[model samples]
Target chain A: MKEIYLDNNATTKVDEAVFEEMRPYFCELYGNPSSMHFFGGQVQGKVSEARNRVAALLGASPEEIIFTACGTESDNAAIRSALEVFPERRHVITSRVEHPAVLTQCRNLTQKGYRVTEIGVDGAGRLDMEEYRKAIDDDTAIVSFMWANNETGVIFPVEEAAAIAKTKGALFHSDAVQAIGKIPINMDGSAIDMLSLSGHKLHAPKGIGVLYLRRGTPFRPFLVGGHQERSRRAGTENAAAIIALGKACELAGQHMEAENTIVKAQRDRLQDALMVAIPNARINGGGAERLPNTTSIAFEFVEGEAILLLLSELGICASSGSACTSGSLEPSHVLRAMGVPFTCAHGSIRFSLSRFTTDTEIDTVIREMPAIIARLRQMSPFGREFLKGQA
Target chain B: MWDYTPIVKDHFLNPRNVGDIPDADAVGEVGSLACGDALKLYLKLDDNKDKILDAKFQTFGCASAIASSSALTEMVKGKTMDEALAISNQDIADFLGGLPEEKMHCSVMGQEALEVAIFKYRGMDIPEHDSEHDHGHAYPDHEGTIVCKCFGITDTFLKKVIETNRLTTAEQVTHFTKAGGACGGCIPKIQELIAQVLGDADVQPRTRPEKLSNMKKMQLIQEVLERDVRPLLWADGGDLELIDIDGSRVQVAFRKACAGCASSGNTARMVEVKLRDLVAEDIVVEEVSA
Candidate 1:
């Protein structure tokens, strides 16, 4: 069966070009960058070039980039460092819909007696700016929020939220794992003190991530070992993945416009067709500014797992906010935090596109989706009653 | 991803009986739209009303829920109502190889719908001991005090599921009934209910004799201590040695982590209770340095 994978927000296929660029370093150039020999020193230059390429995409200095294991590590390091630096500050703040990488860490901080405030989201999944501004105080250690939600594709105003944190002297961090490749970021004069982006989210291989730390932020090391990444982050450099990530970042910069145009068109086409063909359905984060490559549609009276499994039978892969899909027994925290109605919360399906997503893939999804919803709705008691009443 | 069994996949892809019986004899419904999954079952019975002629279901749930419902309909076709009610949740799960532990509630839901359909159709008042959520529905669902308000599951419903499945831990109860699967305000209550169920089973092994001579009582107390109490302490890197027994007063010395521990007083109480439950109601356990 020809697979039509629409779950890019979860992870993406490694780009062929990016994979080829890092091929030579596996055995031929596999020397440790920390070694004194010329073989190792030569590999160091390529690593620095990778750093510069990643820095160029974000409009920041190469030295500001800290290579970690993955996006979760960067998030953990940034928030933990802020708390350690401002140990006297008894407060921290984050949004309710952040990826578990940031949200879990902030929640654990509360156990250590830190007052963690999770600001709420509106019906459209936009952050409550009033709640955020009021939550931050001079005693706050950090404010960690995401640049975009992985589930709903709803973009947050992190820069503006960071500006509010600045007045209170709290370090601001953004988990840009979902937003990095799709959005054009200029971190040069931004109030964001720290930012996190993962490699697998882009075309680079998994297990590689970048933490953009402002040059002069009070910091501590999450990993304390060899003097790697300026001793800010330790462990033997992941040479091949770092090189691949650099190449992927450059490619992301070049294709940024296409991401906003071609990918957005495909996303819009898929969403429009599904909405038109399927009745009693509405888009999540519809009224908010969202990433161009993503759309979460909630079809009422049908559960998401059934739709996803049926989609999987056709080799069309998608994701869901239903409790059965996730290991938990409730809908996704993102949909719940947005106050989505109970009727639709368990039926939301998210389809995210990428630069590699073609129009045919989009068409295949749009063509197969309505009947899938109709079939599951036919099996649903609520769907049969409401649909009958409508007829 | 859930490692769904091939049978579960087959049933979900092409569900066995996927429609409603228009003039069905029994209509049983459970779960609401607010909850993630809901099932409305329609049953067609033979003229005598003793056997199920055909069964169909309309389920709003995941693959497991659909597969479970599909399996239930197939299992009940041509069976007597009593035989259908004998079908436990584990039997439904066993029909599909097995479900993921987290998806066990899907099987429980299937069994509940079957019971509700038959019991309501028979016009019999359902037996229930918990009376918290007794709104007296179209069918007599004496659900009894609602324990998990998020799922609208009652303690009576949960206790039946818990006992039928032989579930031991609070986590197992959540997977089997979704009692503590949300907000988790009732986890402590679920734990209490589990203990209550487990406590009922705990008293079955040894019955306290109605009449016993003093010599027989002393021997039974020592036997209960050696058989039941010592192994439990030994598992926790602690042990207790029986020092002496005189009539109702039995003495023991704590060893290892139990020795000189602040909570040893509580440990002595535990030993006393074990002896009292098995040996004699008036039995008292005393700690002595040996």
Candidate 2:
């Protein structure tokens, strides 16, 4: 059965070009980049070339990028370094809708007597700039906000939020895991002191990530031992995945236009038709500036996990912010922080597209979504009541 | 991702009796939209009004929930009211080859709706339940001090679920009733309730008794075994009978499912640990033949 995978925000399929690019590095070009030998030197050059490719995608210099194991590590390394560099500061600020990688870390800091201020979001999942601005103080070590939420795809104005943190002499970081490939980013002349991104989110294989630390930002190593990543990160290089990420980054730069145009059109088409065909359905972050290839639709009086299971039966894969799917007794923290009503929050399904997403896939989802919602709604007590009123 | 049984998937994909009976003789609605699942069960009685002629449901929840509801309707179609009222949540899950532990509450919801339908049909006075929060605990028409504030679960409701499902751990309580699944502020309370249901009358639950004579320790160990340990094992279709008590070592013989069980060593160790925790610090449990 052909799988109609629409859960790109969770992780993307590894691009074939990227897979081929890293295939030879495993057994063929298998040499330690740090070893002082001719074979090692050849591998070292290729590693540097990969770094250059990754840097080119972010409009950054090669030296600014520190490779890590995954996006979570990059986020941890960036935040921990900021706090270590400014040990006197005892406050960390992050938005409430950040992925658990950053949110959990920030929350843990509170146990060590560091004050954490989680900036709230509006019902549309837009960050509250005023709360964020007021939260920044001279004691603030860093302000970390997500560039685009993984669940809702709502984009935050990190540049503006970063500028506010700088006024208080605090470092600013952005977890751009969802934004890097789907949208354009330029580190040059930007106020963001650090940014973290994941490889697998952009068609690269997992287990490779980058933390772009601007030049002149005070740095402390999160992992320390080997001189790998210029001693900023420790251990041996993930040469194969690192090389794959480099090629993926290059392809992402090449596909940015199509991502913003064709993929965006597909996302729009899906959401527009869903809103039209399914009554009482609305997008989660419809009013906000969102990622080009994402839409979260909440069908009232139905549960998201039920919709997803029905969708799954048809070879369609998606994700939900409902309480059941999250393994929690409540809906997603992102949805709750947005103050979304219980009616819609329980039924919210996120559909994220990619450059690889075909129009037929979107068409398939659009054609099947209304019926799925109708089926579930028909079985819902609230839905039956609504139908009775309609009758 | 739920590791659902094939039966569960089949029922979820092609749910049975997915509608309401317009002129039904009995109707029971449990759960709420805020709880992330709700079910309205309808039952049509035979002309004598004793046997269930038809059963239907309208459910809003995940796959397990819909499947559980569907299974409940199918299971009750031919049963009399007395037979239907005796149906347990575990029975619904059993009909579907069992549900994931985390989703046991879905089966519980199905069972609650059946009881509510029968109770309302008998004209039992069930107060209107608050649906603003996560759980509709009052659906069973029982009230008590709220225990799990996050899920809006009450002590009476939780204790009944704990007793009926034979829930051993606080985690199991959460899985079966969603009582302490959020914030976890009420886990200690849930544990206390579980101990209470298990007949653990010791003042300090799970604390080793202090200053007991060697003979007194033996009696206390037996009491703890009879009170707490045996019931927990029996809940799992297993049993152990006390064979002998030597100063610090206690001997027991397995019965039923506990007999010839490969993991009975772990079970014996669990009994030893429970005894040590509740009776005396040096208590030991050894399994022996009858």
DockQ of each: 0.44, 0.59
Q: Model 1, which residues run further than 4 Å from truth?
A: B125-143, B206-290
Candidate 2 lDDT, tens digit per residue, B1-290?
78898999999989999998989999988888777888889999999999999999999889999999999999999899999988888779778976878899999999998988898889997766555554455245466888887667788888888877767799999888888886899999999999998884345356776688988887888778766786577567677889988888899999867899999999999998888787877777888997
In model 2, the runs with Cα more than 4 Å from the true position are: B130-141, B200-290
lDDT per residue, candidate 1, A1-391, as tens digits? 9888889999999999999989989989999988999999989999999999999999999999999999999999999999999989999999999999999988998898889999999999999999998888899999999999999899999999999999999999999999998989999999999999999999999999999999898899899987999999989999999999999999999999999999998999999999899999999999999998999999998899999999999998889988888878889999999988888888999998899888888878888889999899899988998789989
Q: The CA-based lDDT of model 1 is what?
A: 0.88
List model 2's recovered fraction of native interface contacts, to 2 decimals.
0.88
Model 2 chain A: which ten-residue window has the lowest total lDDT? A322-331
